[model samples]
Target: MAGGKTINSVFRRLAEEETIRRVQTGLYDYPRYSELLDRTLGPDIFQVASALARKFKWEIQPDGASALNLMGLSTQVPAQYLFHSDGPTREYQINRTKLRFKRVATREMKFKQPESAVIVHGLKSLGPDHINDKTIAKVRDWLPEAKRRQVLRDTQTVTQWVRAAIREICKEPVHG
Candidate 1:
Protein backbone atom coordinates (compact mmCIF):
# COMPACT_ATOMS: atom_id res chain seq x y z
CA MET A 1 0.00 0.00 0.00
CA ALA A 2 1.19 3.53 -0.77
CA GLY A 3 2.09 5.56 2.31
CA GLY A 4 -0.44 8.25 3.22
CA LYS A 5 2.34 10.85 3.43
CA THR A 6 3.54 9.96 -0.07
CA ILE A 7 -0.01 10.22 -1.50
CA ASN A 8 -0.63 13.54 0.25
CA SER A 9 2.67 14.93 -1.07
CA VAL A 10 1.75 14.02 -4.65
CA PHE A 11 -1.72 15.50 -4.28
CA ARG A 12 -0.33 18.72 -2.81
CA ARG A 13 2.01 19.19 -5.75
CA LEU A 14 -0.76 18.42 -8.23
CA ALA A 15 -3.04 20.95 -6.59
CA GLU A 16 -0.29 23.58 -6.61
CA GLU A 17 0.17 23.09 -10.38
CA GLU A 18 -3.62 23.35 -10.87
CA THR A 19 -3.56 19.96 -12.55
CA ILE A 20 -6.42 18.94 -10.25
CA ARG A 21 -8.89 20.75 -8.05
CA ARG A 22 -9.50 19.66 -4.48
CA VAL A 23 -13.17 18.83 -3.86
CA GLN A 24 -12.51 18.32 -0.18
CA THR A 25 -9.85 16.79 2.07
CA GLY A 26 -8.38 13.73 0.26
CA LEU A 27 -10.70 14.11 -2.77
CA TYR A 28 -9.53 15.71 -5.98
CA ASP A 29 -10.71 15.94 -9.56
CA TYR A 30 -9.26 16.98 -12.91
CA PRO A 31 -11.37 20.05 -13.28
CA ARG A 32 -13.56 20.16 -16.36
CA TYR A 33 -13.59 23.43 -18.28
CA SER A 34 -16.82 24.32 -20.02
CA GLU A 35 -16.42 26.55 -23.08
CA LEU A 36 -20.14 27.16 -23.18
CA LEU A 37 -20.20 28.34 -19.62
CA ASP A 38 -16.79 29.97 -19.86
CA ARG A 39 -15.62 28.56 -16.54
CA THR A 40 -14.48 25.45 -14.74
CA LEU A 41 -17.43 23.18 -14.05
CA GLY A 42 -18.06 21.92 -10.55
CA PRO A 43 -16.98 18.39 -9.75
CA ASP A 44 -19.64 15.82 -10.64
CA ILE A 45 -21.12 14.70 -7.30
CA PHE A 46 -21.77 11.15 -8.53
CA GLN A 47 -18.21 10.78 -9.79
CA VAL A 48 -16.92 12.16 -6.52
CA ALA A 49 -19.03 9.65 -4.56
CA SER A 50 -17.87 6.82 -6.77
CA ALA A 51 -14.24 7.85 -6.29
CA LEU A 52 -14.71 7.81 -2.51
CA ALA A 53 -16.33 4.38 -2.64
CA ARG A 54 -13.47 3.04 -4.74
CA LYS A 55 -10.83 4.56 -2.48
CA PHE A 56 -12.50 3.08 0.61
CA LYS A 57 -13.41 -0.21 -1.14
CA TRP A 58 -17.09 0.22 -0.44
CA GLU A 59 -20.05 -1.02 -2.45
CA ILE A 60 -22.35 1.95 -2.96
CA GLN A 61 -25.74 2.72 -4.45
CA PRO A 62 -27.59 5.99 -4.77
CA ASP A 63 -30.44 6.31 -2.29
CA GLY A 64 -34.03 7.04 -3.37
CA ALA A 65 -33.84 10.83 -3.75
CA SER A 66 -30.46 10.75 -5.43
CA ALA A 67 -31.59 7.98 -7.77
CA LEU A 68 -34.76 9.85 -8.69
CA ASN A 69 -32.75 12.97 -9.44
CA LEU A 70 -30.31 10.96 -11.55
CA MET A 71 -33.14 9.51 -13.65
CA GLY A 72 -34.84 12.91 -14.17
CA LEU A 73 -37.87 11.58 -12.29
CA SER A 74 -37.49 14.39 -9.77
CA THR A 75 -37.15 18.06 -10.69
CA GLN A 76 -35.78 19.09 -7.34
CA VAL A 77 -32.02 19.35 -7.19
CA PRO A 78 -30.86 17.43 -4.15
CA ALA A 79 -29.04 19.50 -1.54
CA GLN A 80 -27.12 16.37 -0.68
CA TYR A 81 -26.15 13.52 -2.97
CA LEU A 82 -27.04 10.56 -0.75
CA PHE A 83 -25.72 7.05 -1.27
CA HIS A 84 -26.22 3.78 0.61
CA SER A 85 -22.96 1.99 1.16
CA ASP A 86 -21.35 -0.93 2.91
CA GLY A 87 -18.91 1.63 4.36
CA PRO A 88 -19.55 3.60 7.52
CA THR A 89 -22.03 6.45 7.34
CA ARG A 90 -20.34 9.82 6.70
CA GLU A 91 -20.81 13.18 5.07
CA TYR A 92 -18.54 15.36 2.95
CA GLN A 93 -19.09 18.88 1.81
CA ILE A 94 -18.53 19.71 -1.85
CA ASN A 95 -18.94 23.47 -2.14
CA ARG A 96 -22.55 24.39 -1.31
CA THR A 97 -23.78 20.83 -1.87
CA LYS A 98 -23.15 17.88 0.42
CA LEU A 99 -22.34 14.27 -0.30
CA ARG A 100 -23.51 11.63 2.17
CA PHE A 101 -23.01 7.90 2.52
CA LYS A 102 -25.43 6.08 4.78
CA ARG A 103 -24.58 2.50 5.67
CA VAL A 104 -27.30 0.07 4.56
CA ALA A 105 -28.02 -3.66 4.28
CA THR A 106 -25.87 -5.68 1.89
CA ARG A 107 -28.93 -6.76 -0.08
CA GLU A 108 -29.51 -3.16 -1.16
CA MET A 109 -26.06 -3.03 -2.72
CA LYS A 110 -26.64 -6.01 -5.03
CA PHE A 111 -27.12 -3.96 -8.19
CA LYS A 112 -24.49 -4.79 -10.79
CA GLN A 113 -24.47 -1.32 -12.28
CA PRO A 114 -25.26 2.29 -11.38
CA GLU A 115 -28.05 2.35 -13.98
CA SER A 116 -29.79 -0.56 -12.32
CA ALA A 117 -29.47 1.13 -8.94
CA VAL A 118 -31.00 4.34 -10.29
CA ILE A 119 -34.00 2.59 -11.82
CA VAL A 120 -34.73 0.52 -8.75
CA HIS A 121 -34.25 3.33 -6.27
CA GLY A 122 -36.23 5.80 -8.35
CA LEU A 123 -39.17 3.42 -8.59
CA LYS A 124 -39.00 2.66 -4.89
CA SER A 125 -39.04 6.38 -4.10
CA LEU A 126 -42.19 6.73 -6.19
CA GLY A 127 -43.83 3.87 -4.28
CA PRO A 128 -46.42 1.34 -5.58
CA ASP A 129 -49.38 3.64 -5.09
CA HIS A 130 -47.77 6.56 -6.97
CA ILE A 131 -46.47 4.69 -10.03
CA ASN A 132 -48.60 4.68 -13.16
CA ASP A 133 -48.35 3.78 -16.83
CA LYS A 134 -47.17 7.29 -17.62
CA THR A 135 -44.35 7.06 -15.06
CA ILE A 136 -43.36 3.62 -16.31
CA ALA A 137 -43.36 4.80 -19.92
CA LYS A 138 -41.33 7.84 -18.98
CA VAL A 139 -38.67 5.72 -17.33
CA ARG A 140 -38.70 3.26 -20.23
CA ASP A 141 -38.29 6.03 -22.77
CA TRP A 142 -35.53 7.70 -20.76
CA LEU A 143 -33.29 4.62 -20.78
CA PRO A 144 -31.67 3.30 -23.95
CA GLU A 145 -32.53 -0.22 -25.12
CA ALA A 146 -29.27 -1.73 -23.87
CA LYS A 147 -29.53 -0.17 -20.40
CA ARG A 148 -33.23 -1.09 -20.17
CA ARG A 149 -32.35 -4.74 -20.82
CA GLN A 150 -29.43 -4.69 -18.38
CA VAL A 151 -31.48 -3.03 -15.63
CA LEU A 152 -34.28 -5.55 -16.17
CA ARG A 153 -31.85 -8.45 -15.74
CA ASP A 154 -30.09 -6.93 -12.70
CA THR A 155 -33.27 -6.20 -10.71
CA GLN A 156 -34.86 -9.65 -10.84
CA THR A 157 -34.66 -10.20 -7.07
CA VAL A 158 -35.72 -6.71 -5.94
CA THR A 159 -38.91 -6.04 -3.99
CA GLN A 160 -41.82 -7.62 -5.87
CA TRP A 161 -43.65 -4.42 -6.73
CA VAL A 162 -40.44 -2.63 -7.71
CA ARG A 163 -39.50 -5.63 -9.81
CA ALA A 164 -42.92 -5.52 -11.44
CA ALA A 165 -42.46 -1.85 -12.23
CA ILE A 166 -39.01 -2.55 -13.67
CA ARG A 167 -40.50 -5.26 -15.87
CA GLU A 168 -42.97 -2.71 -17.21
CA ILE A 169 -40.23 -0.13 -17.71
CA CYS A 170 -37.89 -2.54 -19.44
CA LYS A 171 -40.43 -4.48 -21.50
CA GLU A 172 -39.94 -4.35 -25.26
CA PRO A 173 -42.50 -2.69 -27.45
CA VAL A 174 -44.75 -5.27 -29.07
CA HIS A 175 -45.33 -4.93 -32.78
CA GLY A 176 -48.78 -5.65 -34.20
Candidate 2:
Protein backbone atom coordinates (compact mmCIF):
# COMPACT_ATOMS: atom_id res chain seq x y z
CA MET A 1 0.00 0.00 0.00
CA ALA A 2 0.98 3.64 -0.33
CA GLY A 3 0.92 4.48 3.39
CA GLY A 4 1.21 2.91 6.86
CA LYS A 5 -2.57 3.00 7.25
CA THR A 6 -3.09 0.82 4.18
CA ILE A 7 -0.32 -1.60 5.14
CA ASN A 8 -1.61 -1.89 8.70
CA SER A 9 -5.11 -2.62 7.39
CA VAL A 10 -3.79 -5.39 5.17
CA PHE A 11 -1.73 -6.85 7.99
CA ARG A 12 -4.75 -6.76 10.31
CA ARG A 13 -6.82 -8.61 7.75
CA LEU A 14 -4.18 -11.28 7.21
CA ALA A 15 -3.70 -11.72 10.96
CA GLU A 16 -7.40 -12.03 11.56
CA GLU A 17 -7.59 -14.70 8.90
CA GLU A 18 -4.72 -16.62 10.59
CA THR A 19 -2.68 -16.46 7.37
CA ILE A 20 0.07 -14.71 9.36
CA ARG A 21 1.00 -14.59 13.01
CA ARG A 22 2.29 -11.39 14.56
CA VAL A 23 5.59 -11.96 16.33
CA GLN A 24 5.84 -8.37 17.47
CA THR A 25 5.09 -4.92 16.18
CA GLY A 26 6.02 -4.86 12.48
CA LEU A 27 7.08 -8.51 12.56
CA TYR A 28 5.06 -11.49 11.41
CA ASP A 29 5.42 -15.05 10.18
CA TYR A 30 3.41 -17.96 8.87
CA PRO A 31 3.04 -19.94 12.04
CA ARG A 32 4.53 -23.42 11.90
CA TYR A 33 2.59 -26.28 13.41
CA SER A 34 3.94 -29.67 14.40
CA GLU A 35 1.16 -32.19 13.87
CA LEU A 36 2.92 -35.10 15.57
CA LEU A 37 4.01 -33.00 18.55
CA ASP A 38 0.61 -31.24 18.62
CA ARG A 39 2.18 -27.90 19.34
CA THR A 40 3.36 -24.78 17.53
CA LEU A 41 7.00 -24.85 16.41
CA GLY A 42 9.07 -21.75 16.81
CA PRO A 43 10.57 -20.16 13.76
CA ASP A 44 14.32 -20.53 13.27
CA ILE A 45 15.75 -17.65 15.30
CA PHE A 46 18.76 -17.22 13.03
CA GLN A 47 16.61 -17.05 9.93
CA VAL A 48 14.31 -14.54 11.59
CA ALA A 49 17.29 -12.42 12.65
CA SER A 50 18.83 -12.57 9.18
CA ALA A 51 15.56 -11.43 7.60
CA LEU A 52 15.29 -8.51 10.02
CA ALA A 53 18.93 -7.55 9.43
CA ARG A 54 18.42 -7.52 5.68
CA LYS A 55 15.11 -5.68 5.95
CA PHE A 56 16.67 -2.99 8.15
CA LYS A 57 19.92 -2.82 6.20
CA TRP A 58 21.99 -3.80 9.23
CA GLU A 59 25.20 -5.86 9.42
CA ILE A 60 25.10 -8.48 12.19
CA GLN A 61 27.06 -11.40 13.62
CA PRO A 62 26.18 -13.89 16.35
CA ASP A 63 27.63 -12.75 19.67
CA GLY A 64 29.51 -14.75 22.38
CA ALA A 65 27.24 -17.52 23.66
CA SER A 66 25.19 -17.51 20.49
CA ALA A 67 28.35 -18.10 18.44
CA LEU A 68 29.32 -21.02 20.64
CA ASN A 69 25.85 -22.51 20.31
CA LEU A 70 25.81 -22.06 16.53
CA MET A 71 29.20 -23.78 16.26
CA GLY A 72 28.05 -26.77 18.39
CA LEU A 73 30.75 -25.99 20.99
CA SER A 74 28.01 -25.28 23.52
CA THR A 75 25.37 -27.92 24.22
CA GLN A 76 23.01 -25.83 26.32
CA VAL A 77 20.38 -23.92 24.35
CA PRO A 78 20.32 -20.28 25.38
CA ALA A 79 16.99 -18.67 26.21
CA GLN A 80 18.10 -15.55 24.40
CA TYR A 81 19.92 -15.48 21.08
CA LEU A 82 22.35 -12.54 20.97
CA PHE A 83 23.88 -10.69 18.07
CA HIS A 84 26.22 -7.73 17.66
CA SER A 85 25.54 -5.19 14.96
CA ASP A 86 26.51 -1.74 13.71
CA GLY A 87 22.87 -0.73 14.08
CA PRO A 88 20.90 0.43 17.10
CA THR A 89 20.29 -2.01 19.95
CA ARG A 90 16.92 -3.81 19.86
CA GLU A 91 15.17 -6.83 21.27
CA TYR A 92 12.41 -9.07 19.96
CA GLN A 93 10.50 -11.98 21.39
CA ILE A 94 9.08 -14.72 19.20
CA ASN A 95 6.99 -17.46 20.81
CA ARG A 96 8.64 -16.76 24.20
CA THR A 97 12.18 -16.99 22.79
CA LYS A 98 14.16 -13.75 22.86
CA LEU A 99 16.40 -12.26 20.21
CA ARG A 100 18.71 -9.45 21.24
CA PHE A 101 20.84 -7.22 19.04
CA LYS A 102 23.43 -5.04 20.70
CA ARG A 103 25.03 -2.15 18.91
CA VAL A 104 28.83 -2.08 18.70
CA ALA A 105 31.54 -0.12 16.87
CA THR A 106 31.93 -0.82 13.17
CA ARG A 107 35.49 -2.09 13.57
CA GLU A 108 34.35 -4.67 16.11
CA MET A 109 32.04 -6.16 13.51
CA LYS A 110 34.71 -6.63 10.83
CA PHE A 111 36.01 -10.09 9.98
CA LYS A 112 37.47 -11.49 6.75
CA GLN A 113 35.74 -14.83 7.15
CA PRO A 114 32.49 -15.50 9.00
CA GLU A 115 33.62 -18.96 10.15
CA SER A 116 36.79 -17.44 11.62
CA ALA A 117 34.66 -14.89 13.43
CA VAL A 118 32.46 -17.60 14.95
CA ILE A 119 35.50 -19.60 16.07
CA VAL A 120 37.08 -16.53 17.62
CA HIS A 121 33.91 -15.70 19.51
CA GLY A 122 33.50 -19.30 20.66
CA LEU A 123 37.10 -19.41 21.91
CA LYS A 124 36.62 -16.14 23.74
CA SER A 125 33.49 -17.54 25.37
CA LEU A 126 35.44 -20.59 26.52
CA GLY A 127 38.22 -18.33 27.90
CA PRO A 128 42.02 -18.85 27.77
CA ASP A 129 42.27 -21.63 30.34
CA HIS A 130 39.65 -23.73 28.58
CA ILE A 131 41.10 -23.29 25.08
CA ASN A 132 43.91 -25.85 25.30
CA ASP A 133 45.19 -28.44 22.86
CA LYS A 134 42.09 -30.61 23.21
CA THR A 135 39.81 -27.65 22.59
CA ILE A 136 41.85 -26.76 19.50
CA ALA A 137 41.58 -30.32 18.24
CA LYS A 138 37.83 -30.35 18.82
CA VAL A 139 37.30 -27.05 16.97
CA ARG A 140 39.51 -28.25 14.12
CA ASP A 141 37.53 -31.45 13.85
CA TRP A 142 34.21 -29.56 13.96
CA LEU A 143 35.13 -27.41 10.94
CA PRO A 144 35.22 -28.73 7.38
CA GLU A 145 38.52 -28.69 5.45
CA ALA A 146 37.64 -25.53 3.51
CA LYS A 147 36.56 -23.66 6.66
CA ARG A 148 39.73 -24.82 8.48
CA ARG A 149 41.80 -23.31 5.66
CA GLN A 150 39.76 -20.11 5.73
CA VAL A 151 40.19 -19.78 9.50
CA LEU A 152 43.96 -20.15 9.08
CA ARG A 153 44.04 -17.49 6.36
CA ASP A 154 41.84 -15.11 8.35
CA THR A 155 43.77 -15.26 11.65
CA GLN A 156 45.94 -12.21 10.81
CA THR A 157 43.16 -9.80 11.83
CA VAL A 158 42.67 -11.44 15.24
CA THR A 159 44.68 -10.94 18.47
CA GLN A 160 48.22 -12.42 18.68
CA TRP A 161 47.29 -15.13 21.20
CA VAL A 162 44.19 -16.04 19.23
CA ARG A 163 46.20 -16.19 16.02
CA ALA A 164 48.73 -18.48 17.73
CA ALA A 165 45.96 -20.81 18.88
CA ILE A 166 44.50 -20.85 15.37
CA ARG A 167 47.92 -21.59 13.91
CA GLU A 168 48.34 -24.52 16.24
CA ILE A 169 44.87 -25.77 15.39
CA CYS A 170 45.57 -25.55 11.65
CA LYS A 171 49.02 -27.11 11.79
CA GLU A 172 49.38 -30.24 9.65
CA PRO A 173 51.15 -33.29 11.06
CA VAL A 174 54.49 -34.22 9.44
CA HIS A 175 54.64 -37.82 8.24
CA GLY A 176 57.84 -39.79 8.77
Candidate 3:
Protein backbone atom coordinates (compact mmCIF):
# COMPACT_ATOMS: atom_id res chain seq x y z
CA MET A 1 0.00 0.00 0.00
CA ALA A 2 2.82 2.42 0.86
CA GLY A 3 4.34 1.85 -2.54
CA GLY A 4 1.13 2.17 -4.52
CA LYS A 5 -1.24 5.03 -5.43
CA THR A 6 -1.85 5.72 -1.75
CA ILE A 7 1.48 7.49 -1.15
CA ASN A 8 1.43 9.15 -4.51
CA SER A 9 -2.02 10.50 -3.95
CA VAL A 10 -1.05 11.83 -0.54
CA PHE A 11 1.85 13.73 -2.04
CA ARG A 12 -0.27 14.88 -4.96
CA ARG A 13 -2.88 16.22 -2.58
CA LEU A 14 -0.29 17.99 -0.49
CA ALA A 15 1.20 19.59 -3.58
CA GLU A 16 -2.21 20.57 -4.89
CA GLU A 17 -3.06 22.18 -1.55
CA GLU A 18 0.23 24.09 -1.59
CA THR A 19 1.26 22.38 1.63
CA ILE A 20 4.47 21.17 0.01
CA ARG A 21 6.29 21.91 -3.21
CA ARG A 22 8.02 19.27 -5.28
CA VAL A 23 11.79 19.76 -5.61
CA GLN A 24 12.58 16.73 -7.73
CA THR A 25 11.70 13.07 -7.99
CA GLY A 26 10.60 11.91 -4.52
CA LEU A 27 11.50 15.28 -2.95
CA TYR A 28 9.28 18.01 -1.54
CA ASP A 29 9.73 21.06 0.63
CA TYR A 30 7.54 23.47 2.56
CA PRO A 31 7.77 26.53 0.35
CA ARG A 32 9.05 29.74 1.85
CA TYR A 33 7.63 33.06 0.75
CA SER A 34 9.68 36.26 0.61
CA GLU A 35 7.77 39.45 1.03
CA LEU A 36 10.47 41.77 -0.27
CA LEU A 37 11.34 39.49 -3.15
CA ASP A 38 7.59 39.05 -3.69
CA ARG A 39 7.89 35.43 -4.65
CA THR A 40 8.28 31.95 -3.26
CA LEU A 41 12.01 31.75 -2.63
CA GLY A 42 13.85 28.93 -4.31
CA PRO A 43 15.09 26.03 -2.22
CA ASP A 44 18.60 26.30 -0.76
CA ILE A 45 20.68 23.97 -2.94
CA PHE A 46 22.90 22.76 -0.11
CA GLN A 47 19.92 22.06 2.13
CA VAL A 48 18.24 20.13 -0.63
CA ALA A 49 21.38 18.12 -1.30
CA SER A 50 21.79 17.44 2.38
CA ALA A 51 18.18 16.30 2.51
CA LEU A 52 18.76 13.91 -0.35
CA ALA A 53 21.97 12.64 1.21
CA ARG A 54 20.25 12.00 4.50
CA LYS A 55 17.31 10.32 2.84
CA PHE A 56 19.61 8.04 0.86
CA LYS A 57 22.22 7.66 3.63
CA TRP A 58 25.13 9.17 1.73
CA GLU A 59 28.20 10.99 2.99
CA ILE A 60 28.92 14.09 0.93
CA GLN A 61 31.70 16.66 0.69
CA PRO A 62 31.19 19.96 -1.01
CA ASP A 63 33.37 20.27 -4.10
CA GLY A 64 35.46 23.31 -5.05
CA ALA A 65 32.90 25.68 -6.54
CA SER A 66 30.44 24.91 -3.77
CA ALA A 67 33.11 25.41 -1.11
CA LEU A 68 34.22 28.72 -2.57
CA ASN A 69 30.68 30.02 -2.79
CA LEU A 70 29.81 28.85 0.71
CA MET A 71 32.97 30.47 2.13
CA GLY A 72 32.22 33.81 0.41
CA LEU A 73 35.52 33.60 -1.48
CA SER A 74 33.67 33.69 -4.81
CA THR A 75 31.01 36.12 -5.96
CA GLN A 76 29.61 33.94 -8.70
CA VAL A 77 26.96 31.33 -7.92
CA PRO A 78 27.82 28.11 -9.65
CA ALA A 79 25.21 26.95 -12.14
CA GLN A 80 26.13 23.41 -11.22
CA TYR A 81 26.84 22.69 -7.55
CA LEU A 82 29.10 19.67 -7.37
CA PHE A 83 29.77 17.42 -4.39
CA HIS A 84 31.99 14.42 -3.81
CA SER A 85 30.10 11.56 -2.22
CA ASP A 86 30.60 8.07 -0.95
CA GLY A 87 27.46 7.20 -2.87
CA PRO A 88 26.40 6.53 -6.40
CA THR A 89 27.04 9.42 -8.81
CA ARG A 90 23.75 11.21 -9.45
CA GLU A 91 22.32 14.49 -10.65
CA TYR A 92 19.20 16.46 -9.83
CA GLN A 93 17.77 19.66 -11.20
CA ILE A 94 16.68 22.13 -8.56
CA ASN A 95 15.08 25.25 -9.99
CA ARG A 96 17.46 26.47 -12.70
CA THR A 97 20.54 24.91 -11.10
CA LYS A 98 22.04 21.43 -11.19
CA LEU A 99 23.08 19.50 -8.10
CA ARG A 100 25.57 16.74 -8.86
CA PHE A 101 27.12 14.18 -6.55
CA LYS A 102 30.26 12.56 -7.90
CA ARG A 103 31.25 9.23 -6.44
CA VAL A 104 34.67 9.13 -4.76
CA ALA A 105 36.71 6.96 -2.45
CA THR A 106 35.38 6.96 1.09
CA ARG A 107 38.75 8.20 2.34
CA GLU A 108 38.11 11.57 0.75
CA MET A 109 34.96 11.98 2.81
CA LYS A 110 36.77 11.90 6.15
CA PHE A 111 36.68 15.19 8.09
CA LYS A 112 35.47 15.96 11.60
CA GLN A 113 33.78 19.22 10.80
CA PRO A 114 31.90 20.45 7.76
CA GLU A 115 33.91 23.66 7.84
CA SER A 116 37.15 21.70 7.71
CA ALA A 117 35.91 19.81 4.66
CA VAL A 118 34.90 23.06 2.96
CA ILE A 119 38.20 24.74 3.71
CA VAL A 120 40.28 21.80 2.51
CA HIS A 121 38.37 21.35 -0.73
CA GLY A 122 38.38 25.10 -1.34
CA LEU A 123 42.14 25.27 -0.83
CA LYS A 124 42.76 22.22 -3.03
CA SER A 125 40.69 23.86 -5.75
CA LEU A 126 42.65 27.11 -5.45
CA GLY A 127 45.96 25.19 -5.41
CA PRO A 128 49.24 26.27 -3.76
CA ASP A 129 50.11 28.74 -6.49
CA HIS A 130 47.03 30.87 -5.81
CA ILE A 131 47.05 30.69 -2.01
CA ASN A 132 48.50 33.79 -0.36
CA ASP A 133 48.38 35.91 2.76
CA LYS A 134 45.23 37.73 1.67
CA THR A 135 43.33 34.51 1.03
CA ILE A 136 44.58 33.04 4.28
CA ALA A 137 43.54 36.16 6.14
CA LYS A 138 40.12 36.12 4.58
CA VAL A 139 39.54 32.57 5.73
CA ARG A 140 41.03 33.32 9.16
CA ASP A 141 38.78 36.31 9.70
CA TRP A 142 35.73 34.30 8.69
CA LEU A 143 36.22 31.73 11.44
CA PRO A 144 35.96 32.33 15.16
CA GLU A 145 39.11 31.47 17.11
CA ALA A 146 37.68 28.22 18.41
CA LYS A 147 36.45 27.14 14.94
CA ARG A 148 39.80 28.02 13.39
CA ARG A 149 41.53 25.80 15.93
CA GLN A 150 39.05 23.02 15.33
CA VAL A 151 39.53 23.20 11.59
CA LEU A 152 43.26 23.07 12.06
CA ARG A 153 42.94 19.87 14.06
CA ASP A 154 40.34 18.36 11.77
CA THR A 155 42.43 18.88 8.63
CA GLN A 156 45.71 17.32 9.77
CA THR A 157 45.51 14.66 7.03
CA VAL A 158 44.98 17.01 4.11
CA THR A 159 47.56 17.94 1.49
CA GLN A 160 50.71 19.64 2.77
CA TRP A 161 50.06 23.03 1.18
CA VAL A 162 46.41 23.08 2.24
CA ARG A 163 47.43 22.04 5.73
CA ALA A 164 50.01 24.83 5.75
CA ALA A 165 47.43 27.34 4.64
CA ILE A 166 45.12 26.19 7.39
CA ARG A 167 47.93 26.52 9.89
CA GLU A 168 48.47 30.11 8.83
CA ILE A 169 44.76 30.78 9.09
CA CYS A 170 44.59 29.19 12.54
CA LYS A 171 47.71 30.87 13.91
CA GLU A 172 47.52 33.25 16.84
CA PRO A 173 47.22 36.93 16.04
CA VAL A 174 50.22 39.09 17.01
CA HIS A 175 49.53 42.19 19.05
CA GLY A 176 51.85 45.14 19.02
For 24-134, candidate 2 gives per-residue lDDT tens digits of 678888888999999877777877898899889998889889888877778787899999888999998877789999999998877877778778888887777787877
Give residue 126's lDDT in candidate 3 (0 to 100): 89
Estimate the TM-score of every prediction. 0.79, 0.73, 0.81
Candidate closest to the true structure, highest TM-score: 3
Give the winner by TM-score: 1 or 2: 1
lDDT of 1 by residue, 56-150 (tens): 99989898899888777888878889899999999998988999999998977888877888888888888999999888888887888888878
Clashes of each: 0, 0, 0
Which candidate would rank higher by TM-score, 1 or 3?
3
The order of the candidates by TM-score, greatest first, is: 3, 1, 2
Q: What ranges in model 1 sit over 4 Å off?
A: 1-19, 33-39, 174-176
lDDT of 2 at 120: 84
Instruction: Kindly report the root-mean-square deviation of model 1 from the true structure over all alpha carbons.
Output: 3.2
Model 3 weakest 10-residue run by lDDT: 140-149
TM-score between candidate 3 and the true structure: 0.81
TM-score attained by model 2: 0.73
Candidate 1 TM-score, true structure as reference: 0.79
